[model samples]
Target chain A: MKKVMLLIILIMMAIVFTACGGENESSSASENEVSIWVHTSDETPEGEAMQSTIDRFNEENEGTYSAKIEFIPRSGAGGGYEDKINAALTTDTLPDVITLDGPNTAAYAEAGMIAPIGDYITNKDDLLPSIIQQGTYDDQLYAVGYSESGVGIFYNKQMLEDAGIDLSTLPTVDQPWDWNQFMELSETLVNTYDTAAIDMAFDDKSEWLMYAFSPFLWSQGGNLVSEDGSTAEGHFNDENSVKAFSFIQEMVKEGYTTITPVEKGFHTGEYPMKFGGSWTIAEMEDYPDVEYGVMPYPTSPDTNELVSPSGSWQYAMASSSEKQEAAGALIDFMTSTESLTEVTLANSVLPAAHSVVEEVQDKVSPQMNVLIQQNQKSAHARPVLPNYPQVSRVFQQAVSDAAYYEENSDVQELLDDKTGQMEKALK
Target chain B: MNTNKRETLAAYSFLAPALILLGTFLVIPALMAIYYAFTDYYLLTPDQRQFVGLQNFIEIFKDPIFIQSLKNIVLFVAFVIPIQVGAALGLALLINKPRKGNIFFKVAYFSPVVLSLVVISVLWLYLLNPSEGLINSLLANIGIEAQPFLSSPKQAMLTIVFVSAWQGAGYQMLIFLAGLQNIPSTVYEAGKIDGVNKWQNFFYITLPLLKPTSVLIMITTLISAFKLIIQPMVMTQGGPMNSTMTPVYYIYQSGFSDRMIGYSSAMTVIFGIIIGIVTLLQSRLTKEDDI
Candidate 1:
């Protein structure tokens, strides 16, 4: 009984604390105060660096609106920040500024929960085109990014060297591998030393597998969202997508890739090359003995454009915000070159602002520049539809079903069925 | 002199707060959800909401993904109940043996019951991770091939059922334990004197007496197991091919992921109706006289 009462009291206190707006800025006569919430787990050094940046912003602002940042830390394995945001929305209280992912930004923006910040970012000439493209929701920008990450081929150089693969004449970004080049290399590299060229975990259950398989779809010009972003077209079962899928299927069949159920292609290091995002750079540095370099995801043989599945995070204002000035100012402070540089070095991602990119590149690991160069012509947000998370999930399941089907299936019919469901979901 | 009027007022006052809370949070939302299910409601974009009467339900029933999710849930309920119930019975039978350390054994087995679902899921995830996990290591030591417990579509559902049974059997075990203690020792002794074997005695006497306890455990567990969201959601995320996607998980996916609160609400209504009917059937079958 005492414990229950104590629990209720604790909950009540949390509600009250969450309700507390940062000490109201005492007008121009007093110190202006703004609250910011960074919705990432606290374990990362990047989050810590971000806190330091917030502290610096506070120190610099003095009596003007001093920006105060708080971390809304989450359990790393589930739900993420959607439930936290939902609770905040219900209470009609929100942080002055929030860092959100691209899909979530679209959902919140479409819901009228977020304010359009195109007016703020468009006027700034330093904004990068690809990053800005990702921040737009319903033809209006609601968020501005400081740093960006995109998928790339991170190869273990020592593994390549041991296999007698020459790096001196490696293809430049323009002359990079198409499907033919990729297959030839994947086959030869695997057979030459009997080492796995790529880790292809056949299981659809792993998050890493989903992340790994996405580039194949993107490389073939397939996408998660419809052209208008209102619906999801079943590109997973498309001809080009199937061709790419069949290639991976053949690799699994031929032993060119690591198809082990327990130990996957990359993390097991059975495969020297890993197709992952810039997020891997920080961890890659720990492998000091393994010489490695990052390159753009191979171009589609058909599209001829170097396409990469990129994802970004945005800082924006909540709809119920009464303190728009404070929110806007906080967002502005976070997006500034100083903060962007800190995030770039800490997170090992490419800076969003063009000017900031040039400055921060030298500060971060040298491998991170691959993201910056890749961002120039080959970047994309995964999908920004309100139904994107579900869409990806449903698509992943369909692809997995097709991949693991013991019997033959009508691929087109499967694709048609998924599209029909997506249409209904959009409706 | 005015005792009747004062009594009426007291009754009204006693009911008022509860009525208000129920009306606001429960009863009202339940009605509103039915209405929303017929509309094209988006939680984030309130303006996009428009009435489309029966369209959402049509869309859902016809949806292949939704159909797969439903099929998965049915399989899950069918698989988990037997596994969990059987395990619970076995545990009850074992622990019913009053030995020197029976109390300690009961406490050890029941410790998982007190743990939070999220904590248990995390612990299980680490313990089941194919490469470095303890279970895999133990299996490797025995020369058995490492299994993809949560990563293979064929294995994921069964693995989850096993984990769920492991976590939940203790609660049902306690009820079975009570039922076991209630059986008079004279019946077993009389059966022994009549030349009945131990197995025969259990089959005839113990089984008949434990029917009520079994029924009680079954009904409660059936209702509670339908709410299995936290485990699969946190662990597998209904993945490896929607093998773990239960109806409640689908409800969350639709309402939050798709932002079609109306469609999700329709799903909720359907869910409520299904549960309501199931409960009624269960009660009808397990009436006192029938026992």
Candidate 2:
């Protein structure tokens, strides 16, 4: 019996060893073949559009060059997909063409994980300024986006009308609502509607905080980091930055905005207004009964300056890729005016290319035109620094603290704490 | 001599596969973590890591977030172990008989254990929502004001502890049930003959017999409590104001989100040492109880 058991165990060990030793043979791509890794799966319209683009690229090149895509799921722990990309970088297994969040471009470029595509991209000047700003690192173009994203105030039209607020009198991009008027409107709407005035999506304690609210800081003439990008002390803790955050703290304190709101507060009519992204346009279509309109971010009460958050996912070439030329070709084809129009239409996003925006101007809804105009005029890319991930996190936490403050809670102190954290991280 | 050698070889063959797996997955990575903890290894620039000696460890003590995380986890362990172990014991005692509905009770008690922690956390997040969640809605129905169970900084950690204890008690209950069954019915009958009442029998006989089982449950629950990450990460994101930031979640944030692999590794090393010391102390106490 002992001999039989020992023999069985030995056979099991052999099988295990064999299984462990089996190497995954890399699919032998021809010299002309280039592989891409995209975050979106083929289930969505955007993913399908991307796939169709790749298929068209392959068909056009025929035997000259081919592009294939491997879909990577972006959902998981906060940085799960980025972690996968980082692992691939370490193992020298990164795909030739890679799509990454625009804000990550600086970090990837600094780490030498992505190569600059300025020499390959001819239509750099045609791309929207915000897109160009987001994709550039050290004054070099490292990535290019096909579509841009912007956030604006989405107000319930019926609720606003019921509150006796005239739609025509509302702020426009050229003459946006000053911070004081915006707060007064929010207060009036809350009393009239008997619901939360605005949904700033405090529950989404991630990149959303920095993306949607940083415009307030910028419009107030404050910046996340200095021009040198070496320090955040004077810049993040500046008078304007403190004032900008104070507005948010006051809103939360007075119950104008909720620190913990239902996920779809505007769609469900739980709130009169929402500081929502362009993606909300698609979501609003689901609720046709609830009429809504988009307005530019409210201007700073002190400066009357208008700024809107901008930047979205962009494609780049991996530094380790041997087929850089072919990868660059894939990126160029994807971000072309024609491709941008198709993708922007399919995804219901603002087109990155200036020509695409102009060509599709009359075709899209009036609400979309608002986003397009903002993307062109008022959009400001998030701080394009290598330490952006850290900067965004510290700022997000500080904002959360201020928003969830109780009595005696200090907004300036929170901001100063974040400033210190950012300084330490930059070291 | 040849026969003995052959027997030893056969035993060694039987152990090879498990040993190899352990060495590859757990032992090697643990050693690597120790080595990396002494470096400045950023996840993005893995090859550019340089030795920083005790700098990372020294910094960890000074990091307010890390200190807060340490305090939070210690509090979590302190509250969760007793509550969970007690709940498990209560449930085990209630269902350790041959009653008609005992099987049903066992399944009901253990259901939460089978559910994934993420699913449980998400479900509780919805149930605990202050405005429109099921719990608050029910509270409103009862003419009671809604409680901000998760949103309040004061209540968030305690709420998480209660939810974690509720979810985890069932697994430990099964172990306690086994310990209960091992105590012979004859022992109880003997106590009954001596005119000992039910409560007296339980206090004198059942309580002493359960010491080993209690120690085992305490050690396991303590270890698991110290590793609390998923609940806070999914439910709170360690906020209202970093009130629920456990050591493990902080380690995860440092390693993955912040990409500070070396600093995170140092934290993991410290956390591992703490867990090790706790386990050793628990075993030693249990052994002394046996003596």
Candidate 3:
């Protein structure tokens, strides 16, 4: 009994000592330390480039400030990194700087979790308009996206050829095909293959629904919310939005796309075309047998305006940080033209700045260059709202419910029903 | 101190670690959940929380998605309890007597219980895929058309029920096996002396003796069935028109993904009450059976 009690006491003492040791170590580094939390594993090329950028920043700012980076990888359903950030918001243990998704700028800024770093950026004019638009909330730049992302129609060259489609007549960023023409091509492919013509990642059933499919709504002259980001009722359920929803529903109804696509159908050559983003470039490297090419988004038949989704992870200064200047410096350094080019080239992502685009234009693959071109010409960022997640979820469910193609499945009614849900979130 | 007091102190000291862990991880969080249910606590703006009495609870009851989730969970629990418990008892009976290569059958039946639920869900997702899955190919060979297992809202909840039961019945089977072993052989011997056949012996003796174990399994399985989240989260993501959305999954989505902590807490509290009532009802009925 005595020995057991002594053992317990020793264990307790050891735990106390370890806890104190950890606090002492952190405090020692707290004087000039600028901690950063990123949303990727360290082993990835993007994470390595981020670390090198931080190391360079630390070297230049040596005795004045030191920056430390922590990588918190997100899971498939967008949990780990965001979960840590949410927990830290309550506990007040957030790092000096943290990485957040682009659409979250409004939420974070409105909640006072992130500070505006617009004045910190040295070359703000050099950043792409879409990146600036994505990072800005209420006319203040709360976050700066390091890399831009854009979705495009990825088509299998062989399948298109087999379906008797002309290669030279395909859409380009400058002169994109209209939705009617795109559907005609989808019809041909479906008739030839006797299967779903495209994989729009409908099976993902998450943010991808809004991210990849919202372009259609935008091209049709519909907005998820008003320009003021105040309401989603008339805009989300308006005629233009209904046209976009029905267009999506038509594809599923006509057997041009499916709600449940085969996993990696495009990569495996099971589907002729895929609605894919810039990240799909890296993913396509594994599929050596399939030769693919990128095409700009199909414009709406009525408006003929091209639009594509744009948003990626961005860096922001945490509101809890006392050393705001140092945090701002780190954010500035990481999003500098050179750092952006390095990160973009390493991750195979679209460039966030014009200078980085010029630097990586010749180096990146032609497929990626096509996406970059579309991004510059036609990218539209998602709606920036404090309750963007709920709004996006409602939009996602609307897409899913509409695409199921049952009797009495009124697209307008579905949109109106979903609009009510979005309105609740917006409120 | 007296010897008795010292012993009691030592016993408490031994339990200190587990008690502290439970208090920190479970008890405090539960208490916090109850308190947060009455407030408007958004996840991002935690410090800006406000106490709005019964607002969250009232709002959740009105929310169509929450009501749909409640309906789905109840349907799941209603189907899963009997299917899972029946399969467990069937397996327990199959392995009760020693047979050739019995260990292999036991291991095979118990293997899925040890595997992670996420892995099982993913594997089943591929197997249940409408077109390219192995199950479809096998069905094709048998001249049965491919079924849209997870894609059809009408079929998704039932499909999940089967997958969950297949994955969960092994552990319950082990418990039933123990209960079977605890049944005295002398009782069976006396039944044999009374000229009772095997069927009569099982129906009259084995079943009557297994009531306590069956009741225990039913209560546990009932509680777990109410907490179905992982399978839907991994498989369908509460989709195909929210056909498989369980209450727990909706609560997680509300709190973590949608960042509506107050609403989610209200949901958790309501779900807890429902479970408590159902469990009480089950136990009351079982007690009457004993009487």
Ranking by DockQ: 3, 2, 1
lDDT of 2 by residue, A321-402 (tens): 9999999999999998888888888888888988998988898888889988877888899988877778888888878888
User: What lDDT tens digits, residue by residue, belong to model 1 across residues A1-427?
Assistant: 9999999999999877766633332343433566677777556767887888778877877766677677777545235576677667766667767878765766777677889876655336777776777777778888887777776777777677777778765555666777667767777778765766765444434434445566667778776556786665555556766665655555555656543333434544657777656656666656566667776666668876677666567789887766777677777777888788777777777777777878876665556777677775666665666666666665665556555434224556656666665565565
TM-score of every model versus the real structure = 0.83, 0.93, 0.94
Residue runs of model 2 more than 4 Å from their true location after superposition: A1-29, A76-80, B97-100, B141-144
The candidate that achieves the highest DockQ relative to the unseen native structure:
3
* Model 1 per-residue lDDT tens digits across residues B1-291: 599999999998999999999999999999999989888887765556799989888867866656877777677778888988888889999998877989898998898899998899989987998766899999999999888888777888888888888999998989999999999999888888899987987889998889889888888888877767888887787876677888888898788766678889988888888878887898888785664
DockQ of each: 0.34, 0.53, 0.66
lDDT of 2 by residue, B64-156 (tens): 999999899888888888899889999999998678989999999999999999999999998999888999999899999989898888899
Better of 2 and 3 by DockQ: 3
Error of 1 at A128 (Å): 2.7
| B1-291: candidate 3 lDDT, tens digit per residue | 699999999999999999999999999999999999999999988888999999998888899988999999989998999999999999999999999988999999999999999999999999998888998999999999999999999999999999999999999999999999999999999998999998998899999999999999999999999999999999999988999999999999999877889999999999999999999999999999692
lDDT of each: 0.72, 0.88, 0.92
